[model samples]
Structure formats: C-alpha cells, structure tokens
Target: MLPLAPSFDTVGWLTRDLATLDRVVRVMLPEGSRAASGAAIPEVLLSVLDPAVVQAFRSAVALLVERGGFDKPDDVELPDVKATYAAFRTVQAAEAWRVHGPWLTEHPGSVSGAVADRFRVAAAVTPDEERRARNVLAEARGALRALLAERTLLLPSAASPAPQASAGGAEVDRVRGATLTLTCLAAVAGAPSLSAPLARVGGAPLGVALVSAPGSDRSLLELAGALVDETAVP
Candidate 1:
C-alpha cells in the first residue's frame, strides 16, 4: 500500500501449497509467459554469503541432482552482486526521497528515530549518484536478461540465517547488505524470481531461489511447483 520504493514493489499472495500458489499466480499474472530451458546455480554469489548459507545451497543442489534428476549446470560468471546492491540502494533512496521528502518536511517529528535517520540518508543522495546508479541498473538489467534468456539462474534467497530480533544495528546492517547483494539482481533486472523453501540450515528454512527472464512469471511458477512436487514424493 505505502510506497517506500514503488519500483521494486510487487503484488504478491501467500499460499500453503504449490497448487494453490499456481492458481493464485495464474489468476493474477497474464498468460503466455515462456518456459525456461534449464536451470543453473551460479557460483558468483557464494563469495558474498556466509559459509553456512553456501553449504546449505550446495547441499540443496546436490539433492536436486541426485533425487530430482536435475543436471548440474556449469559454473558461470555473473555481474558483481555487491556492486548491483550499491546501485540498487542508491536508486531506491533517491526515489524514496522523491516520494516522501515533502511529506516528512511538512510533518516533522511524526516518524521514529530509525525512520528519520533512513530518510535523512535518502535525502542526501546526490543527482550524480542517482544518474550513475541508473546507468549501472540498466547494464545489470541487460546482463541478467542475457544470462537468463533460456536458463533459470538459481541461488540462495539470503546471504545468511536470520539474525536475532535484538541484534545490534551494525550486525543487522551487515546481514542486510549481504542479502541485498543477492536480491538486488532480480529487482534491478525486473525479472521473475521464485524462492522454493526446499533447503534448511540448522533447522532454519533456507530458501533456494530461481530467477528467470522478464515476463516469465508463469513459467517460473510452474518450474517451482514441479521442483517442489518432485522433491516431496516418497
């Protein structure tokens, strides 16, 4: 409802099962999306994730190969995830400031300290920084599209396990930065991404993500459903 950063905001629904999720997606998204030719687990992101996350992802991939009979895709180089996160944050802050700056100014002392602090940072984003970020985003979009034209790009949903609610700001920021590095790719590229909760780390659900080309929402959903179903069978 609120436009914190409208560009990356999506209309999504929650469903308990793959069939229900498929139904919801079909009802919401238009038909005629193309299917991905295959899936690839890109290793570029491993550098930014915690060792636990990396191990979980690799274990999940192994299961996909041994149980699901899925082929292991060759390791391929990808655009820098950290750089993409930086560019995404810059653009997001600039846009957030554009949308909420006037309101905040008119209603001083309305928002909390953390919110105020974030808005201050958003407010300080320079025009040149925004321009450069946009350029980087454009390049990232193209690169992602090319890489995912027929193949689905697979990776971990987050860089690490969930942090404690009472964790300090610095620790939270560190984890958030690493997470944004992976998530920013799909957002910047405007592509479809599906996170299948088929992996775990020390009992915590560690989602393995599947990213496909733009306009491939239905296809991506189908792929996710198939994978989930296959893994669920006895």
Candidate 2:
C-alpha cells in the first residue's frame, strides 16, 4: 500500500481461512456481485521452473475442476509472456520513479544500494519506452478482460517454493522473476485475483490464484471458498 507502483498497487491483507477472508471482503467491498466467468498453462510460464512449483500449479488446476465443481478451463491463447512481463516492468518502474524518485534522490544511501539502483533504473525510463509499454499493456488488458468475460484464469501464486531466510540474492531474484511472470497477467489486466491456500509442495504451502473480471471479486471469493471446502481433508 506504500505505492510501489500506483498502476498496479492495491490494498490487500493476509487471512488464514476463506471464512475470515469473506468477512473482510464484505466489509471492504459492496455486495450483490454477479458471476463472470485455462485448460493450458503457458509453456513460457513453466519454462525453466522448479519441478515442484510446476507440479503444484498443475495439481491446483486439476483440483479446482475435479473437486470444486468448476468447469474445465478453456484453453485460451495468451499474449507473449516475456514481452508482457517486460512491458509491465517498464510501466511499474516508471510510475514508481514518479512516486518515490524525489525522496530517494534527496536521501542518498537511506535505502539499500540495490533499492537505490532499482529507483535509478526507473528514473531513466524514457518517454518512448513508457509509451510502448503502455500500448502493450492496453492490448494485454483487452485480451485478458475478454478472456475472463465468461471464465476464470487459474494460476500459481509463485514460481518457486519459499526460499530460506538466508537465500542468496541471485536465488531470490530468480524466484521473484518467475513469480512475477505468473502474477503480472492480472496486474496488467487490472483484474481481481484471488488466491486459495489449497495446495502444498513437499509439505510446504503454496496458493493457487483465480483471476477474473474487475467487478466479480465477491463471486471469485465464493469460488475460492468452495475450493477450500472441497479440498479440505476430513
């Protein structure tokens, strides 16, 4: 909520169960939401990923259909994953720079060198680059909104299992990059994405996400609750 990038920033919270999440959603969002409604995982999204992460995502989708009473997701074509991620990064960075660059400039070394470096790169985003990225984002938003007009797109919350507290920067960045590729779809589309903490990999928890049309968040949460109840162990 600190305005990482206003274009993609949203206010969300952590909840332990779907019931609690529902309570919060009722207070935060208006009622009377209606339904809006992927059979294929993009290879680009799965390429070079950890086997555990890949399996978790696939299993999550299967669970949604096999148990949650949801229909098999339609196999829809997505725009180029790598290109979409790049454009999202550009717009996010440019907006972030617009928000925080002045403060960062005034306070040298107040933040980590890596954080400062990222802001520096953001500061350097050119007008032409931002414009191109905006165009790409516009197209992607349309494509995704249309795709979700009648169906939800399911996804993994991250591309890798949780890393150790002491994980190196390179390992962290690798996970972050892959995770962003999966998440940036909803961000670029400006859609509502809900994650159900219903999957595990080698006993570690991983969440599966449901992305849907903008006004369909309440219904999406109801679907997520169904997934949780359906998959819960006796």
Candidate 3:
C-alpha cells in the first residue's frame, strides 16, 4: 500500500501560506494522492505571486525526498542546470536593468526608471568580470534552449528498465509503476509558465520547475522514487 499521506506541515514546505499552497498542491495532485479533500484556491493565488517562495519550497522538498536530481530518470543535472540557469538569470536581469535605466532617465516617476540607478550599477561591472559573466550567460542560454528542445526524459533510452519485483505481484506492480510515471511526466509538462509570473511576484527571476503537478502526490512519490533508484545504481 502507498505510504500514509505526508502531513500538511511536512508538505507545507511547498508554500508559505497554508491555504494558497494547498490549492496548488490540490490542482496538481491526483485524487488518489490527496491527503484530504479541500479547496486551496487562496493559497494558489498567493503562491503565483511569490514564485521564489514556491521555488524554495519545491527545492526543499526535492532535497528531502532526493528526487529531481541530474542523475535521475529525468536526466536533470542539478549543478549544471543550476549554473546555466543562474547565468541566464543574470543576463536577463542585466538586460532588464539596461532597458529600464534609459527609460527611467527619461521618465523618472516610472518604476523601471526609478529603479534605473540600481540597474546602471549592476550593468557597470569590471571589464574582465563582465566578459566572463557574459560568456557564461551566453552558454547558459544556449544550454537551456537545447534542454527545452528535447522530447525525451533526461536519461538515456538504453538505460535498463527497472527490475521487476517478485513474480506473483510483478505485473501489477509494473503496470502501476508505468502508469504513475506517465502521469507524473504529463503533470510536469503541463505546469504553468512560471517565469513571468515569478518575476512579477518576486521582483526577480528564480528557477522554476519545468514540470510539476501541484496536487499529484503519487506523481511526486514516483518521481522521488525514480530519482532515488537511479542515483543508487552503480
């Protein structure tokens, strides 16, 4: 049988406000995975506004669960993805400042213009550091684009299938596992475009899950299990 549902406090790491977090989790989770039935609409709205909080919550959960790693079936390399993502984020931030700086100069009262002074400072870095930062940013953008273009799970298609359990229960287990995995992928793929929303809420860009199902506990467990299994091999 599946493990008992994780407590709200335990899952609370998924968001700051209990009500808002609960909504996102509910929408993303499947019926079988819910800890209990309740509406979390308020939590969802608040969460969308603070993407960083949501991201922090997600990262914490991933670390605790040991899923969503680079070596997992998802083929996400945390370090590499993070490095690339950070670089891209830097570039995006700089560009935003660059644009806002001039606009702010022209229209002082506009928020972007008002913030231009800070942007100008960020945009003006030491030559050597700036060059290195630019190079890293370019590389990161390319890497993200490539990842976005891919159609398959991160792991090699040739990786051996997970071993079957003992004979009598093996087929049932396999079918269940496969179904769960597919459901997880679907949910992750269908997640909202968090980039802009995150920026609007957090006043900065943060790494967002490319795929996540808000309320799908089974998917979460399956993903966590896959990451654990893959990481353990060899």
Tens digits of per-residue lDDT for model 1 on 113-155?
6678888999999999999988988887898888888678888
- TM-score to true structure, per model: 0.91, 0.91, 0.30
Q: Model 1 compared with the native: what TM-score?
A: 0.91
Collision count of model 2: 2
lDDT preference between candidates 1 and 3, better one: 1
CA displacement after TM-score superposition, residue 31 of candidate 2 (Å): 3.3
For residues 95-193, write the lDDT of model 3, one tens digit per residue.
555545565567765654424444565566445654665686455445433333331222111111233455445554544333333222222222221
| Each candidate: RMSD | 2.2, 2.2, 20.3
Query: What's model 2's overall lDDT?
Result: 0.79
Residue pairs that clash (backbone atoms under 3 angstroms), model 1: none
Model 2, stretches more than 4 Å misplaced?
A: 37-44, 230-234
lDDT for 92 (candidate 3): 41
